[model samples]
Target chain A: MESSQNQFSEWLNKQIHSSNSGAFALSPELRATSLSVLDAGVFPNRKNEEWRYTPLREILSQSPVLADKTQINPALIAAFKEAVPNALHLVFVDGEFSNEFSGSISALDKTGLTIEHISTLHGESRKRAEDTIRQSSLSDDNIFQHISLGLSRSGLFIEIQKNHEVDRIVHILHLSTKSESRNFSNPVHVVRVSENSHMQLLEQYASIDAGKALSVPAVYIEVADGAGLDHFKIGLESNQSDHVSNTVVQVASSGVYKSHQYLLGSRLTRANLEVIFSGAGAQASLRGIYLGNADQHLDIRTFMDHAFPHCSSDQHFRGIMNDQSRGVFNGMVLVRRDAQKTDALQSNKNLLLSREARVDTKPQLEIYADDVKCAHGATVGELDKDALFYLQSRGIEKAEAKLMLTRAFAAEITQEIEIETLRSYVQDRISNLLDGVHASNV
Target chain B: MLSIKNLQVSVEDKPILRGLNLEVNPGEIHAIMGPNGSGKSTLAHVLAGREGYRIDGGSAYYKGINLLELAPEIRAREGMFLAFQYPIEIPGVNNTSFLKKALNEIRKHRGEEELDAIDFLDLIKKQMKLVEMKEDLLKRPVNQGFSGGEKKRNEILQMAVLNPLLAILDETDSGLDIDALRIVAGGVNKLRTKDNAFVVITHYQRLLDYIVPDFVHVLSNGQIIKSGNKDLALELEERGYDWLLDKAETRD
Candidate 1:
């Protein structure tokens, strides 16, 4: 494990040295911080509680080659961007931001929203992005976050001004063009919604054809007092692709932060999301569905910190595994000593469609404060037998009945998506995924 | 239209239906009454092709085709319907869409063109009135959170929509009040015709008063021990099933 870890670190060093003139070079201070963390030579393994249930061997065994410029299918991009019909599009192909496909941020100059590429930002803008990155509450041992900070060559810095209600959503599409080698991308996105503001973001990661690549994108979000931010992340990479992402979010007084994730693709995916309430009367609602097929392995970890009083957090995640796929959901809700009147709820349910398919869900609640309400529950089972027989008795074929019940299980989560087009797009993708799953009554 | 000859079934190596037999022609309603634990539900379930039942012997033929060989859905598509005694509450499945899908599948099996959304809605609305079912219940999940009466009414509504050749009501009046029973039986009466038949299974004779049966049979120990006309139900209602059981035992 250590030797494999060294291989990854060595590869990271090579990436930093080879991309001499790449876009979005890390600042000297950021580079030094990342180097110090990497110098510790402490990479997560199965021994690490946070990394348990997820094997890093697949990602660490192979080296990533620098992606070469290639022609991407215009129709593919056109079809993928249809998920969000009316939104500010930000296209990132092979790790670099595509100016041709992206919308003009200049049009939003008077709308009190500042959207800038990390490489183009200078002086105060750069400093603000860096400041937010420094203030991220992610633990120092998260080497992946630091790796993205130090070696990222493509990212964006978005800020919504105080009291501004941004009507348009920021739709970021990470399109991995087909590559001959196993390429890698780690784009760091930093977003700050100022006081009393509201914003929505749709971040999607997908690949062209069955591209073999690794994406370790890191995101930092800050929702100020009275602000609201709806962040949705969808991992729809190809079956040959692998993804690992880190999201750190902080919400201030009376702020609202809602996160919805759909992990429907990729051979292996590990998503770590941490939300910390920094002030009183704040709320956080987290919802996600991880649907896997074949040999896919999807893992989701969430950490909700109720450090302030009068704050509430609720998380509901569902998993559906088919073939030999496996799913893992590990969530922890913490109420600190002074965090009184805190309400937190966490639930995780899983459905195994095949005998080989499996799921491991652990929901943890640690309450140090009195006068708090916290509840958690977890369930893992196959589709309801009675329900299946019921549909079959109604003349729906067994395969179609299984699909309906599976789709309905997912719709329960996708219905929370406020955007009609996006919700439909996600639901359609789920249906397509379920369609390909062999109806084996194992 | 339906024939059962010495049908034998077992559950987990324990015999539930020793040798149940019955026969009914088109346009006739046969009411099967029995005391509890008389294999009433088992016969209904076995006929509907539910799993976990071992068919030890005997044969059930519908239109001269062996009913035991087909899957539950195939049996359903072949114009066989079973209104469950305990309707399964399926969350996330819309009642209207479920019925529509059932109807379309059966139509497809019959080489008939499927109904579009508009036509289906029209047909469903017209049939919904037969059972006095609320329009909102059509939009909700199938039988989820429905009152006992509503579930029974939904079953009748489904029967009305499907128009099966042989409809078996397995204790449809079990949990219904008198008014609900009337509405449900009324729905069945409206859908009756010369081309289809009904098998009304119940524990009490009250339901027979509304949906009068041409034949009444007493099922005991998984076999029809006694068969009589509709008046037999009233006699059983007055004397209870013990008298029939005693007479059958004396004959054995």
Candidate 2:
């Protein structure tokens, strides 16, 4: 494991010194920001609540090598072709952007939106994201501000201009292929939504037979005042993968930020969805659904920070754990001092379909504003026996009845997605998770 | 026909129905009149194969088959019905849908084809009319938000739809007005046939007045002490259970 870590670090250090790493145009500060994060260190085994559930120790012990930055694997390209046919299809293999496979993104080639890799962007194209990440920080210790600040990967950066309405979804597909041996992979992203801009970003993650793929991906969202952004992600990594994806969304004055995540793969997966409502009347809705089946273990933790007055956010997350799989949902809603009229609600409900399956749920609400309304609720229970019997009495077999109730419970989260195409896609994927039944069957 | 030969029912190791015996032949409405604590409801439950009640002695044979060997649902499917004194309130389940499921299960058990959605709706509408219940009531959850009289009428509606071979009415008249009783009794009377029987377990003879019974047996101390024809019910009603108490003591 030490040798693997040393090998991975050595490879990353070489990439930093490589001149082609700066082959594309970049601001001096931007180039430094990319190299500084990698130079900092590999994430420790356990420190933040975000890294709690995933099996990172085993990933670190496997001696993962740095992902090859110069090439794209045919297997990963093939998988993305089948999984996301309608997507604009931006492919990133082993933490490196691939121009050969994703040069002209179909979704980003249209008007009203500007999409480019962080390495290719120059001047205002790159400065805007860094400035938003800097100006949106309410504190010096903000996790996303530092993580995104440290993010060095040359990944997708989407900019939806002020007041521009983008009807098409911008899909970011990150695929990893660690050829011949165990490897460590890290990917980072930054997205900026201009004032009053409306757009949806769909992120998909997958890996194929890439031994010990360690994906520590970070996506940062900057929503300007009065702008609305929808961020949706689907994490379906190969079975031998360890994924740690963190999303940091900051909302400006009266801005609306909505996010939905679905976790169906990764041997051990943990996702942190944090929304900082920094401006007055800014609304943030954090809703997502997760499915854990077989021996897979999935953990989803969410944090909503209400740092401004008159800001409202509501979060509802549900998890379905079957077989011997385990799931965890920890949601915290924090209302800071002076953030009055901050109405935020957080709830997490999980269903453990089998006795062997387990779910640990926690909902915490911390309110410093006396006049604010904040509430949190968490419920962990099994399927209602009477409800099941009632359905069975209607001639629906046990499996079918359980599926119906599970779908109904999960449907609440999917319905909250304003993007119909993404919503339907998630619904179909969830149905397929049960028994490959398409969402249209419902 | 339904026959209870020296049946003993116990709950929590205390015997409630001690060697009680009664018989109901086809084309008969045998009203089992009893005072409180006389195990009147026990007989109804025992006949329906409700759980937690143990049969310590004897046996209950319904249509030549041991009724105790069957589950509650199987017994229900085999044309044996027990109208609960306090019907369970199943929320989130539509009343019409519940009745349709029960009706279809019973029909399938009898080797009859199940009814479709349209036919089931028509079936429920016709049965609902038998008890003079409003059509809207059928749309609500089973027994949820139903008044006492309405709940009882709905039970009778279920009986009419299921068309059981033996119908045991446990305090069916306990919570009903005269009009409601007349409608429920009229529905019961309309379904009476030589191939079917009714075991009306009541606290008072008032219910027997609407659907006049062929025989009346007084249930006291878990056993029948006196038996007579329809005249006995009116006589008992006129003189009250006090008269039967004296007659029971004299017979002892």
Best by DockQ: 1
TM-score per model (chain B): 0.99, 0.96
**Per-residue C-alpha lDDT of model 2 across residues A1-442, encoded as one tens digit per residue:** 3575565455556656766644433455644655566676455454555455544555544545556664555654765555335656677767667667774742244566777766666567667766654554332132322333443545667887777887766678777665655445555577888888888778888775553466777677889889998787888787677776667788999999888788977778878777888689999988877788777788887888888999999988888887778888878888999799999988898888767788878788888889988878888887666555444433334565567667767876787766666677677778778763323123
Whole-model Cα lDDT per candidate?
Answer: 0.89, 0.74
lDDT of 2 at A80: 54
User: Could you tell me the TM-score of chain B in model 1?
Assistant: 0.99
- The TM-score each candidate achieves on chain A is 0.96, 0.84
Model 1 residue A232 CA deviation in Å: 1.3
Candidate 1 per-residue lDDT, tens place, A1-442, comes to: 4575567767876765664745545577776778777666467877888898998887776777658765786777888888898899999888888888888865137889998888677788888888888887674248888778878888989999999999989999998877776668899999999999999999999988777778989999999999999999999999888899999999999999999999999999999999999999999999999999989999999999999999999999999999899999999998999899999999999999888999999999999998999999999988887888878777888888888899888888898899999999999999998888844442
> Which regions of candidate 1 are displaced past 4 Å?
A1-5, A16-26, A439-442
Docking class of 1: medium
Scored against the true structure, residue A334 in model 2 reaches a CA lDDT of: 86
Which segments of candidate 2 are over 4 A away from where they belong?
A: A1-20, A23-42, A46-54, A63-111, A135-154, A175-185, A206-213, A392-403, A415-428, A431-442, B1-252
Q: Candidate 1, residues B45-109: lDDT per residue as tens digits?
A: 88888899999999999999999999999988999999989898887778888889989998999
